[model samples]
Target: MAVHLFTEWSKSPGHLDHWERTGREQGEECGLPNLGQTCYLSAVLQCLYHTLPLTHYLISQAFKEDVVKRSPSRGQVVQAAADILTEMDRGKPKKGTLAYFKGVCGRMDDLFAGSGQREAHDLLSSFLTWVHQDLSSSRNACKKCGLEPERRSTISDIFEGIHRATIICPESGAIICSIHERFWSLSLPLNNPGETPLEDALQQYYHTRAIKWYCHYCRREHLCHRQMHILFLPKVLILHLNRYNIKGSDPKLNWVTFPTEELTLDGHLTPGQKGRPWSKFSLYSICNHHGNKKRGHYTACCRSNHPQHVQTPWLFFDDEEVRPIERFKNPRDAHILFYIGVSQVQQESRQTCLASGGMGLQ
Candidate 1:
């Protein structure tokens, strides 16, 4: 049954049977073994493994000191992740499993601890938060100021971005105040997905609006213009299409066409960011949900930038099965989109396409 899906996706019967994908054959990573209902975890692990920045940091073993300094129990999540990523990178035992990482995650987070299934985005979010917390330096409040220090780590540096909203008073257009907030992902409003394009959604995100403000600068209750802009861009940008509502609303299944090659943020950026180099991102990975919240299963389709994976440029990861995907063609199931920063020189070649026929090689 599952084999049929892979066949249709690859459009090649012999592709999945290739011996190289089965084991650790230098530079080739093995499929993650999903025990019955562990497809969500398997998909998440595969997506994270292909995240070059995070995977590189893990394989580089920069977290060794952080692991050693903390209590053995507190450091297990990142350590476990590092172990699993390394195993995937170097390959081992024909396939892969995340027993240790799952165990550690189950221990720290109740979502994975239960016998029942968990959502992929929830699981991914938790894993990143746990790793970031473990690697961050601030565990306790400052001794002198009694303030909890800001948590900082390479994880934050890679995945986080800052947004600033400047409130301007109507009176003489005086600057009221600037509010800055850090975010790991961009949550889009799906209230009206009927005719919204990706660029329109992005524009709405940084849109300027009017608000009733009692600004100290104005010293009165007057209309103030509130404008928001991206203060800082992350190396990896995540767009979380808010499909499932916590209040039990129906999930938005409408498809919005998004640019995979040049998702430029110049218009949404502040004047300050213009001074910096090209502020754009190219699509890297996508976590697609197949069904509704109750019965949905997640799968990841990642764009491989690594030279070794050029042959299989677009790889589909469904549970333990990995194969070349025929085409993306504006995915309606796109839930989480991962975008990576690219320079002007790097953006010259826009191979934003899924593989088709045979191996889908260059």
Candidate 2:
């Protein structure tokens, strides 16, 4: 908690010039204009824009084919998304660029219902869900029974993860629950953000917690242990630190030192259940939130793959303003962290020096 978050308003002379120059060479550096309290929205989109594979898919309009195959009704949202991203890619970051995206989302029953301040994590999850539903092969069916065989989509293939929760009654030796589901992100607790480490938070996430429950088999209340397991890991991993406590007005402030290079989940996976056979990830993007829930600003620090700037392939995105970031390895107020498999990182770096895509702001 000794560390303080870096606000976007603070700046110095251009230092990561090499990285910025590389970004300009391989991709466009666009900034988003903040419309009212729309900084949260821009922050998340910026992170997604820098996601090379996603940019390639959406910009190429590959998702349209899936939309056609699935249903015509869903194409509207996908098309709007494509249009927004494409527009962002072709233009520079500035004010009034997010009209299309805002219009579309606003029309969706006034997305987020009505908002002055919105949660980035919620917006991200909702957007991904919409995209996944639009592209998925099936809308309803059993995933475990093979009833819906080809249910995957670009969104599912990239961001989705498989998790299984097992709960056992210690005294009765009977099961109270067993559930499995897909996850788009991992929400970690930050009760004491100042003192919590990234690894410690993760451990708490997968740790078994004891709960009192009535065991039907035992006909009495027993202390049950609930444990979560990772059956599969996604290509792009999103970790959202749960900093907002609705009961309180303020959000968590202290920063947690995370693994900027390589993060391994060798011990976290279910035994013999590594669906993707890859549990190692390397940090690539960060969505840092500054201030509290009432008034906060979001910024993104992304990894750039310019070979010449190997020592510093990182860029800071504050809406439409793009700059080189020398010290992105540890962001003090990183609310959400993005990571990709180490193997995939190597593959992407070799295949593409930079990726092109766009996002909206303000």
Candidate 3:
């Protein structure tokens, strides 16, 4: 849609008034996908108009056509556009809009470059927490899926839905979040940096210890597809897991699974269980394309979908200090939510930024 609009607009050599109507007609038929495409392109057009010093006719046409027509005039889309162009002098670029994009890109670059160090710092924090606490029970084993139950009972799980957890860029503190229940937890070691790099220490810890040397993707090593799996067990059983610090601000934890469409849980595990695990059992399903040659695919319960002993635990932030200003109770304390993260691509975009001169590595 953007390409089509750009092509048409670029060719139309008439006055702004003449082309404005044409673009509107085009956008009307474009549908929702086209609307998004136009908005993104409009942002770029906005940048180019200001920087390149286009003629007044061109600028006017772009705004009235791209900005005015596509904008819904009610929700955030139009409002934000209006806010950006608030101080728009006749025929000039909007100051607010330019500043907004520039700030976004600049901040993104800052985080991407410093991400490695920030992850290292987070590892230190995780290590300190692990060393300081003397857990009553260290191993809660689940024979079916080869996971430990003890680690699943941390504040991250206990207070799962209270307040949303944040998944910051670790480097820039820039945030990207998903729904609370979709977060994913991976185990990696921080204190004992035997082989893995300091930055990925925590991930390594999770892989080695929590996964029990099994591969989550292939399941050859008896590892579940994800480090964090929802298991069904009896209420009387208590889980013990290793505590790991969260990296971002988006209430959701980082984990993987395709959209719910191609994936689902078993009957017993279908209507997920809260505190009690044994009462009901559900099958955890995943669409994994990691090792397969056939693009990506979904991998469901080839084995058991229960928690294992000596598993990694989740950690939560948001005590009195991080709580919202409102007087309402923390949401995490009330609902039953899972911690999951977006896919690798989404996580990376939320995490890294690149600057012009140097290649930013995070």
Off by over 4 Å in 2: 1-27, 68-73, 91-97, 109-115, 139-151, 172-177, 213-221, 249-253, 305-312, 344-362
- Output the lDDT of residue 138, model 1: 50
**Model 2: colliding residue pairs:** 30-93, 31-93, 31-320, 32-319, 32-320, 33-362, 34-362, 35-362
Whole-model lDDT per candidate:
0.68, 0.66, 0.24
After TM-score superposition, the amount by which residue 241's alpha carbon in candidate 3 deviates from its true location, in angstroms, is: 21
| Model 1 stretches astray by more than 4 angstroms | 1-29, 71-73, 93-97, 138-149, 210-212, 221-223, 246-252, 275-278, 308-312, 349-362
TM-score, per-candidate, Cα-based = 0.79, 0.78, 0.17
Q: After superposition, how far is residue 19 of candidate 1 from its true place, in Å?
A: 29
Root-mean-square deviation (CA) per prediction: 8.7, 9.6, 24.5
lDDT of 1 by residue, 171-231 (tens): 7788988877777888886666465578987887778899998888757888899998876
Q: In model 3, which runs have C-alpha deviations exceeding 4 angstroms? A: 1-117, 120-133, 136-143, 146-362
User: Candidate 3 residues 1-362, lDDT tens each?
Assistant: 12112112223221111222122211111101112112222322222122111212233333333232321221223223333333232223344454453333224344312212122222222321221121112445544334334433221222121112223233233333311232223233223212222224323432312222333234334422222223432211111112134332222222221221111222213124332311221111111111211121111111111111001111111110111112211121111112121223323332342222222211
lDDT: the better of candidates 1 and 2: 1
lDDT of 2 by residue, 1-362 (tens): 12211111101211111112212322355667777677788888878876655765787676767885344334665676677666666655434546556655666535554446687888888778777767877455534422334466778777877777778888766678777777889998776636577888889789998988778878788788888888667778899987775356245545577876558776677766653433467677889889887678888887654332234347788876789765445777789998865554443453353343221110
Q: Worst ten-residue run, lDDT, model 3? A: 301-310
